[model samples]
Target: MQHSVMEEGTAYEPPTYDETFPVLPESASSSSGRLNIFSINNNLQLGRITITQMFRVPGEERKFDHSDKFGERESIRTCKTIMKETNTIIEIATSKDQSLTFLITGKQNQVLEAKRRILTTFQTQASKQISIPKDHHRWILGKQGQRLKDLEKTTATKINVPSVQDQSDTITITGTKEGIEKAEHEIRVISDEQI
Candidate 1:
């Protein structure tokens, strides 16, 4: 015979990113230039804080450059080319089409500028439905979610990845518009590379 078990309220509060660090103030709308210096400065003040943002645009859009041979470049070359074209920080990793995720961090305006540059370079358009796959979700999530955690620390964007059992494909990227675009492009680029 087995004894019945009793459930108790958890006294252990879950750890949180907010509680672990200080936050930056929102950037003023009046700032000039493509990059928002105030926001960037705020992030810098927050102990090397960089913003993680994502964007959703049409996938097929791009600026035509007949001079460069993108297909001929190596993986590192391709990553460098993408970074150079976007004018923002980038990291490349291998994954399936649906599993790729781009993580970006910087000032609000800088992040936005980066998104625009990347979109233009790739010639992608915003799509109503983003069919992100199941297997690739792990690359964005990283081991124990520490990759995303690091991204959050720098970009200040709250990134949520569904558990393996969740069966949901959408990776919720919460941040400023610029941040969203940057992150989304990175994801798409990585996915394209894998393909």
Candidate 2:
């Protein structure tokens, strides 16, 4: 039977030793079917020193059963969660193993913040917030809302600019802690540029 061995599970088999007289070449052996293979990789002479071997684990092997269905299911679940939880619409690309890459488009700052938050929340398990000044808010928000829109698109964070009547100078950032820091830092930098 043809079988492929994978590095998984817990089963060990010791290799049998050759105790007989050495009358033949090293390429020939009679023992457990562990194939020790050696070859000169490329045309270089020094490549002959390294040896490679293929081993068969009696019953341990990996079979990939799910293909597109598994990835689609995971993507759907993640998309649903992202839509329901946040005010952002994001496109998801998933690998066969259910890994995700988000292609998000929205306000520049919001997007950047969101990406930052998503990365940090899943990768670093951190959370935080940042505040932006009202005067500098115009810079972050930009002229005719273009600059602000650009900020949202770049940061991936929803930038909440309080109305003149709100009497608040702080622009609230909602996303992952790292994202918040990044968005906040960018806005501050923009503010500094105006001065």
Candidate 3:
């Protein structure tokens, strides 16, 4: 992992347990997965963050007669409600070109949850069903699902390629219609490339 970043021209090295991190006592560790993860990531920064995301509403969904760009300020209302519920900070701005900008600041999980909710609720999302051999699911998911995460972030879609246990054949994709098609095509491409 360290060597990979070095190859990418990162000036400083990522922290390792040798110097900055602490080793936990056997007695202090427990069975809870989340706790174990928190301990491991303690060396990683957990500071608050502020991010801005901007995008224009699709023309078909635009309501020109309305005040806001998309004519659906419901997205704002939903986000505000989620912020209040999660105790996160979210500020929204509009642009002349029918764009909506989101200013979000909060803890790591808080920001992620708020942003996900905003995107899923506000955007034009759809679900598509694809049947791939259950055994091939892992190829699409990749190791620890890093591949699927990358695909989602790249295509702005969510892909559910079934687990080994369920033996389910149907993979459900939920996102923009375009994103679904992109993800589906990429999944097939990945499967083909692997072969």
Candidate 4:
């Protein structure tokens, strides 16, 4: 067989076969012609997405007490668990108004599931204030505060009535919207009965 050798300084040219075969672009010229498949796989694997959402909890932004800190810790733990379970990243920020902003990043389904679980675990609570005569405070309190405790338990709410020395007629109820409504109605009824 005859051999051909090219000079070192000369540009090498590839020999072409039949003209009927078309030349492929650099991306599609691989031996397996799987460049498009690889690109698609890259897109699927590297396509990370993020969503930002804000949730408002009704009430003034007050200083956190011990109970509040405990609740906050539980909420943080829940978020961390959700992130691990769904393979998502969650960033939570608190606004001056006590609203929470959550930034979740991951695949589309993972992010969505994380958001749903977080929102479900932390339902927004609202606080409402209603006024009754200071004289009616004892009626709401009942004997040794048993009535107040029962009301709180039944309504799934926290009811804060003004102290004897405070002289304020306002009572604060905090809970879910429905719970607050029910507590407010019962409190009003108790006060009206004393009339």
Ranking according to TM-score, highest score first = 3, 4, 2, 1
lDDT of 2: 0.53
**Using alpha carbons, what is the TM-score of model 1?**
0.32
Total clashes for model 4: 0
Backbone clashes counted, model 1: 25
Candidate topping TM-score:
3
Q: On lDDT, who's better, 1 or 3?
A: 3
lDDT score, candidate 1, position 40: 38
**Between prediction 2 and prediction 3, which has the larger lDDT?**
3
Q: By how many angstroms RMSD does model 1 differ from the true structure?
A: 22.2
RMSD of 4: 18.5
Clashing pairs in 4: none
Q: What TM-score fits each model?
A: 0.32, 0.40, 0.50, 0.41
Per-residue C-alpha lDDT of model 4 across residues 1-195, encoded as one tens digit per residue: 998899989998776653455556754556463334433455544236554433443334323433444236567787889989988888877765655667777776576566556544564567899989999999999999999977876565789998899989999998767668988999999999999
Q: lDDT per residue, candidate 2, 1-195, as tens digits?
A: 997575788576644445443325654664444656788557765323332221111111211124424234444565456545555566645454544555655443344445544443333233344466666667776678887666655554566778867767767775444446777888788878877
Candidate 3 or 2, higher TM-score:
3
TM-score between candidate 4 and the true structure: 0.41
Write candidate 3's Cα lDDT for 76-167 as tens digits: 57766989976678776666665566666777556656665666765657799998777678888889999888787666678887767787
Misplaced by over 4 Å in model 2 are 1-74, 77-129
